[model samples]
Target: MFKIKHVLLLSFTIIALTIAGCKSQFEKIRLSNDVAKKYQEAMKLYNKKNYSKAIILFEDLSQKYRGRAEAEDLNYYYALTLYKLKDYTTARYQFKSFADTYPTSKYAEECRYLGAYCYYLESPKSSLDQTNTKAAIDALQLFINFYPKSERVADASKYIAALRLKLETKAFDNAKLYYDLGGFEVSNYKSAVIALKNAQIDFPDIKYAEEMDLLIVRSQYNYAKNSIEIRQEDRYNEAITYADEFMESYPQSKMLDQAKALKADSESGIEHAKRMIAEFQKNQEKYKAMLAKEAKADSTNTTIKTPIK
Candidate 1:
């Protein structure tokens, strides 16, 4: 039993020593003044998929070899190392710089594509700011335009479509937010109508198109309902128009019943507004007649008082 225990202890010690030796060797290469040796060892580490140490060595080599012929390959490898480390933000800048500095290099096209792809990787969720998403779309489109016949054009187009869909989702959510706030301020209903319409225009093939149409109808109805009597008829007429269009477009929609109800309510509201306007005009004529009669009586009294003088 003692012999077996000693063997186990010796095995663990040997394994630990080997790991320490490997780490020391890497540190020696990192701190060494031999630029060629460092560059060779960095390539070995990268090929072995040891990015953490490879990136350190590559970064140093980039500065040591600047403006030299070796710098071109060093910069490309550095950018790739950063990408493998999942440092997309830094990777994108390095890739773009490499392409700009070495426009005639054989790797220029590849670096440009990688830079644009890095932006795609950095795109945030739909609920977050979409600046990165827009930038990604622009970068990818530029790649396609620069290399129209390249094999990567198809991939670039696909990424642009995905980014556009994300933007569409954000727009849909924003317009729906106004609708959700409609109860707090009646004017929000009008804002929702305008926003949703704009979304439809921006994303003609949007996935949420059906939902947006229904929301437009509902928003117009509520907007008309909250308007003043004099403006109600025109607003309700607009509501009816939107509802009619929704029903025609989505004949088999689950929201068809809701759209139909809005149309009926808008028609009823228009009739009510017309009746109120007629009654208001009739009362206004009566008021004017009363004022005229009072003025005539005062004039007759003034004439009689002046005749004696």
Candidate 2:
């Protein structure tokens, strides 16, 4: 057992020393003043997939080679090395810088696409804040516009579609949140209706179109049902309109029956709301007439006695 432990320790020491020696050798190359040698070593490391070391060398070379003809290639490789290291944020900036600085370089188009792709990669899921998702869509769309005939256009279009879907999902979730909160505050039903409508307007090809339309009908009806008497008739009428539109647009929908039922219910609700409003106006008129009659009687009783004067 003692002999085996000694051997294991010796092996570990040897491995650690070998790693240190290799790192020292790389450090010497990195700190060297020979620009050509540094550039070549960096390229060698990058080709070998030793990106961690390659990036350091590339960073130094970037500063040394700036304003020279060699700077273009160095910058491109630097950005690509950062990307390979999974440092997407910096990589994206570097890539954009490369394209902007080298508009005529052979790698400019590729760098632009890569920069946009980095944004796409950074986009979070639908539930999170979607700033990055929107940015990705814009970038990818711009790429498509700039390079309409490029091979990457197809990939960019596909990515744009995916990002738009994410935005749609976020909108759907937001509208649903308002609907869910409707029971707590009836005004949220109105908000839900508005949000769902905006979602449709913004994304005409939304996959959740049918579902969103159904929600709009439900939200409008509920909003009308819970609203004050004066607003109920108008809101219920709008609900009926939405339900009709839904059924017209999706006759074969699995939710056809539900939509039809909502339409019928909304129609009934409008009638009921109109009656209630009419009854309220009638009561108001009666109240005003009663006050007028009381005022007239008081005026007659309080007449001045001229004979006493």
Candidate 3:
């Protein structure tokens, strides 16, 4: 009889839990349905071109079902609304979340692509922060990698090329900076190579090729002229390196003659400095006697006094 009572108690407990779970589930479904209904109404307004009212309803629906399945579509639409309203960052995150959660979705692909575009659309020109454009390029690459045959592949490639031009502009500017700075050994050399190579890659047939080569020549020439004799030899050698690059990359450059002349000058300047040093060393004894006399006088403990002889 006692065992029977225990069994009866267990049965009652199970019934109570089931009833509670059903109540909880029903509440969730009711809430989700209400939010979904609001989303539809907003979409209808949006279709009717009632953008402002549609935005309000979309905002409400999104808030109501914040963590539920019904929220997915609403979030995407919310992002679109924000984008239309010119609130970029919020739109980007909403689109980002949608993409992450629904990778296989048709809308997800668009979100993934457009999320980066949100950044790109706000991106300034090549003179400004290229951070957004770089990020967009990366995101586009990923999209292409994941969906090779997607219809958006062509569009992604187009953007990549456009962004590439921005990068090219930045590189050209850097090289120009070095040239303007009068080709200081460190700063000029640093930016020149970067700009030259990038220009070669992007506008191989453009005037930048010859322009960069000319810049390299001028800066390197001045650098070799002022450097110490031994260091000058190294600088001349470095200049030769630039000459070689020009020859190889821009064989037909109108600047080739100038580059060759500079190369010849570097070769001769190194030799002249070496010869001058050698001639100096040939008179080393005379220089040493002068220096020794100066050292002896400087090291003397006694001060010179006028002495009567």
Q: Per-residue CA lDDT of candidate 1, range 60-151, in tens?
A: 89989998989999999999999999999999999999988999899889999999999999999999999999999999998898889999
**What are the root-mean-square deviations of the candidates from the true structure over C-alphas?**
4.2, 3.6, 16.3
lDDT of each: 0.94, 0.94, 0.76
Which runs in model 2 stand beyond 4 Å of their true positions? Answer: 1-13, 274-309
Model 3, 7-116: lDDT tens per residue?
Answer: 99999999999999966754454355576566776787677776676677787677777788767777787778877777777778788888998787768988887776
Error of model 3, residue 7, in angstroms: 86
Clash count, candidate 2:
0
lDDT of 2 by residue, 102-201 (tens): 9989999999999999999999999999999999888888878878999999899999989999999999999999999999999999999989989889
Comparing 1 with 3 on lDDT, the higher-scoring candidate is 1
What C-alpha lDDT, on a 0 to 100 scale, does residue 261 get in candidate 2?
95
Could you estimate the TM-score for every candidate?
0.85, 0.85, 0.68
Q: How close is candidate 3 to the true structure, as a TM-score?
A: 0.68
